[model samples]
Target: MNSRFTGRLHLPGEDGYEQARIGRVFNARRPGRRPAAVLEAVCEQDVVEGVRLAAERGWQVAVRSGGHSWAAWSVRDEALLIDLAGLHELSYDPETEIVTATPSVKGGDELNPYLGRFGRFFNGGHCPSVGIGGFLLQGGQGWNARGWGWAAENITAIDVVTADGELVRADADTNSDLFWAARGAGPGFFGIVTRFHLRTRPLPKHLAHTVHAYPLDLFDEVMTWLHGIHHTVSDLVEIVAVTQTPPGEREAVLLVTGVSMTDTPEQAAQALAPLHANPYADRALFRIEAQPTTLAEQLHNQRTANPEGHRYLVDNAWLTGTAQDVVPAMRKAFTDHPTPQTFTIWFSMAPLRELPDMAFSMQSEIYSATYVVYGDESKDAEYRAWLDEAMADLQPVTAGQYLGDSDFTNRQLRFMGDEQWARLRAIRAERDPKGLFAGYLTADEPPTNTNHWER
Candidate 1:
């Protein structure tokens, strides 16, 4: 920013810089050194300028589109922030059954309707607010995952801004290494992603959407039942457990979502009717909606309530095995420090993977559940600390972290395995040897700081 460059530089003192740097969750502590200059990248050309300038000045690089990366790695102090909000453009081809969506194209909403109109759909996250560049690259776990596959498996192509800031397309046929790594490698290891072209499949009408709430007293029982049901359900089921501990209390929502890929909602209900038999005595709150709509609507109701005004600090982890006793342990942690924040937990798993030959980071597959914790900013740090301690307590009892949700824990890194971890490290070194592109991916951290530093 202090240096004279061809690109637009909004210094820390600039008027627009502060507002532009605002993250998805306000007051949600923004870490890392603040960037001295911010590049409002309006187009591919702007991205090139920003990359070029950053490299020339030897500045750290960071990329931001939706600021949805749980780590908020998009922003940094004294580094160069390359904002991608200006590149919100989407192109859908019905004939090819593909959607080329920008980093800013809230992937679910932007392309779902088009895909629906085309009678097609893509594997995406539970939340409709998630963007393509981050979600797909981070490894998407969708509600439809019961049948299709992980969100990453469906990606067809990507347009990325490499370390030097050149716009390149990566896919099965191009930039093969980068393409394979980006499937679930996340943002920090490489450069910025401008857009993505994803494969789509035919979508069916009259899908069943359901939500069932169980009592905390029956948490263990519910988890026990869930374990047995997972192995029995039809592939048309997308289930997520919403577990929360609000300072001094414990509550849970055992959501059972069934998406009928075939006709006859009545038949789908009959198929899933066995689950309804277990009565939870007033602790049960259920919604079995059989409607003719797109996955976008189904997710919108699940992820975001009010898009215009809402602050959310989201955290993640992967839970495997059964969550029976882990629930009680989590309840204990919540009791230790109670707050009014609405903390939440998101659970997901990759059903029998299809890409046996593909080298997805080994850690990506182990987790049977992905926990996405969201809450108000007031109790942000406290809740986060509690979640970690609680998760650690459950480590001996539950599954490990989900790459999509877990932090940079050294112990967790081992989950990636020595060979796999070496491959990722080698990839980072080979692609960005100078580590110039490291800033944006983890721009919220200090220089020389490793992820999950405390751990």
Candidate 2:
């Protein structure tokens, strides 16, 4: 009903309010807080105006670009939700090797459509429906993270709407600090990002994978062998292990899936050859499957398996030591899953690029997580507690936490390390002097420096 806003706004009990209130992964229906209003911004101007309105009325504003936060931080109680779903748009410059898009743009639905045409692709999240905004901001762990780096490092520039309702550009040569902060700021960002300019890469000619399954009895042996062979594997490959019950199975099984990015089938096979060379492979193997596929095909299966509607309890930790060091915890995480649908993932990430100085500093050798998925509300508390206990057991081997999968309220310096945390707080205080966008991520209080710091 606000004429000044360039987009449609829905208040509580409004006709479209329920539909607009949904977050990507978290169904906002249960224990719903009911935001003060949801503003579906149609363009950058709409976002600019909406921010000004929220500030004028002294209302807390929560920016929602992807709506996929496992914790559902975007739709908070009594806050004004700036929904960017209506702002979906994408553009690419061949000569510049850069792709620019509105915050609401998704990797599978919006990006791949155009990227496939140009024979170019950006390293984005594995999920098709994930929005580019939060994915990149939270240090995107894309398909081949080892070969490329965090998706945030590929971001060349960002157009941010600051707390003062002014649009500004943050990049390397200009507003450097803001650029550095925005790349890995997660949900703690002090401004609303309207657009992202990212550097693109040539799409690999072939994407293929080989999978192996082993019974829980072989978990330790298989895990030790896999970790021991890490150095022999190529950066073009990724090996992930999960524990879940297969179709027609009553017991949980440990499945190892390995993917490779290469120019040809032969190259892909060669890159993954080390996996099959394990001397003890035959003793632990239960099944094997291999295939060559496109990114779209892979994402399709992922979406089908983990569809929207299910309740999820997600948490992750970065392993400081090798997989062998965390074998006991990993075994327990998978074997004792709360439900048949629940899964625990171990990501073998070997960085090929020099780590950048950013807020996303949890760059350990391997990343481990438990994804507890179910539909029954009655079992929510039970599943959450299980995940908490699993993570607690893993704490000894963990170097830090991943902000994207972490509980914002409980996040500590371990996620970004103490130095980065201090710097983030200082910048947050200077930029958001009024603490306008506080508690969107970690609840750490910003510094008291109201004085604007110069670059």
Candidate 3:
């Protein structure tokens, strides 16, 4: 690691150094490298002051909240990282169903207590520790996305510390452009978002989730079955397609993890049964097991922490139809499962049916999918090489990656499309003119140039 940093710096020897060096990937991609200095912000003023200091000293700055970006962009080399991870504060009101939280509050249990205080729940990605800033900014297209809209759609307002350190509120009327861009523009684009006001609603009557795993040999049949199910399910059901390498398996497995909010798990499972009764779904595997649990509990199960120090490679794209041609291509690659490594291939078409197309991209709203690869650091070279190769190999079939599972790359352009990309870039040009908070550039960069750093 390079040891040269010019500023009022914080080195490895400092007490606060370790805190800022933490990676967001939990058990993988531990950046291990530390930034030159860690700007600990307690309040909005602290954010303004810290960013102002970084700007004055000409330092490249990255904002840190839950630190869960796939690339660990939060803790990059030579950065005067703004550690907002410590600024935990929240307030939720029953009457208004409006919940306000600091960028670092993590918006799960910290938020559940408040929402539970009112017997209400706000729609968010099930990851308990995922910060509202990154998730919402990236167009949080998951479980509740089809129901409540993306995180950006649910957030009423945001308290942002801009490039030049001015604290301001952005919402529908005042900063409409920023509001639009923030919804799905991916995080760290406009500036450091300090606080957020999320719109909460009542919990559904029943939260039914189940995982159905199928053999790798029947991957094609499974894909077809999934496509058929997605084509028929009602608007309220949320389904996820995870094409991953199961434990002790050489060929990749198709795991359909679904959560339905119908009257009963039986009803939900029955609604999905037609899609499951095919040869692919019946390829000698256990059936979908349903359970009843609170939305908060469901989220906790999804993002539980584990021991650190593995690495990951993930890319995404949304295939609209059944993707008849894509199934076979994946099978050939499935056999060469990289060691200490696994992949998560998911499919969904719920969110598109739920939100207005004019505002955010509907790419993630349909039969969307992601390719995830995970392994220990020892195989970083082998896995990373495979990731790049596989993505290049798979690009002809689909485009448009999901932000929830994407990394920093020029490959991001396909999933969101050109029209939406132009709008987001325009918003970035206007609000964040100096481009201070410019860490998570889409894997697929658009036609324009984004060269100027924090100025």
Candidate 4:
């Protein structure tokens, strides 16, 4: 070990090795895979040291902040993990309505309180425990994403440590290419982001939610109706459907949830009027109550449903057609899921205001995925096969997998289009020529670039 490395470093069987390996990943399939050493960084200089050490030792580097990579990409065997758990600092400027956060401390649970004091909040994902580093970097899809757009759009600047162990600020005007590429590449990115500067919004005056539970027999009609309902509702209304077996029930049930962001209950009711008018309203098991709730409450509920320790194998895609076009395959997938814990989600979103020039190019009215959850390692192969088959069947009706959920090992298509990927690759090569970072770029022979970094 190098004395110049100022932060703590742990090897296998060491005191902190088990703790360093502890993360949000519940997937049990890759349990024994371990990092060569875990570098627990306390400061930006320590990150620079870790990168420099990896370069000197000819070892690849895996970076982790909140440690919620669906595929557990943060803990690769034989690689050095730069764990940023100690760097959780957050600050907000009320006058400017801008929030600044360190990589590890930017999860919704960590930042919501700070923002709440000023009646300001940023768009984060449904899960409160998701670290902002990976979430916002991969084009964060959050509460009312259609209304606010991808959470990445709210980011004004970032402080990043490049492959050369030099700190640089990236934004529209400075280090512009790195700024663009950083917005959506997820684990495929080339640099380690230390801090994020994001613009925040005034908290919604009122938040309301409603749920409709329908029988499985109505899957086709209900799904088709759910897909088209987005077009009729206000962008402030976000709707989702999850199909799973409720406790004590022998059959699967479809729970359609809706969130309306408005100033009053009356406005929320108006926004959700279309859903209330469903012809199958009679068929759905009756439960209709729209009540106000806080952002913290909503996020907390999402986190509780998906607690730590449960393994998750996720597969998702951007919809290419109406729900009517793809409901049969979805019905089959959900009906035969291995366990009651397994479920599918449908996020019917509004159109983006404008496409940002980043690697997260794919978009559709609906984003869909299945999360297979189980504690047993014995069924790992079965769940993996089920998810793979489901995703394969939906490929024709999907644009591509979301970058955050994408498994780089069996990558079929990318989250970005071909041109966006080419641009991202060029910038990655130019910035990190040595491939010190661990990800898809380093996993394969990296793309060649005539333009080289000024080392």
* Per-model TM-score on C-alpha atoms: 0.82, 0.93, 0.83, 0.93
Which RMSD does model 3 reach against the true structure? Answer: 5.3
Residue-wise lDDT of candidate 1 within 341-421, one digit each (tens)? Answer: 343443334355455323354432123332323445576566566656655654554433445554442123222334544
lDDT of 4 by residue, 179-273 (tens): 99888888878889999999998877889887788987888888877776666678888888888777677777888877888888899888877
Model 4 quality (TM-score): 0.93
Every model: Cα RMSD to truth: 4.6, 4.3, 5.3, 4.4
**Best lDDT among the predictions, by candidate number:** 4
Task: Please list the C-alpha lDDT of all candidates, in the order they appear.
Answer: 0.59, 0.77, 0.62, 0.78
Count of clashing residue pairs in every prediction: 18, 1, 19, 2
Kindly list the per-residue Cα lDDT of model 2 for residues 260-354, writing each as its tens digit: 87889889888888877766568655645347977878798667556688887888888867665688766668788888878888887854366
Candidate 3 lDDT over residue span 174-273, tens digit each: 7666666666666546678888888877766777766777776666777665665565665556677665555565666667766776667678666555
Give the Å error, residue 5, model 1. Answer: 10
Compared with the true structure, the alpha-carbon lDDT of candidate 1 equals 0.59
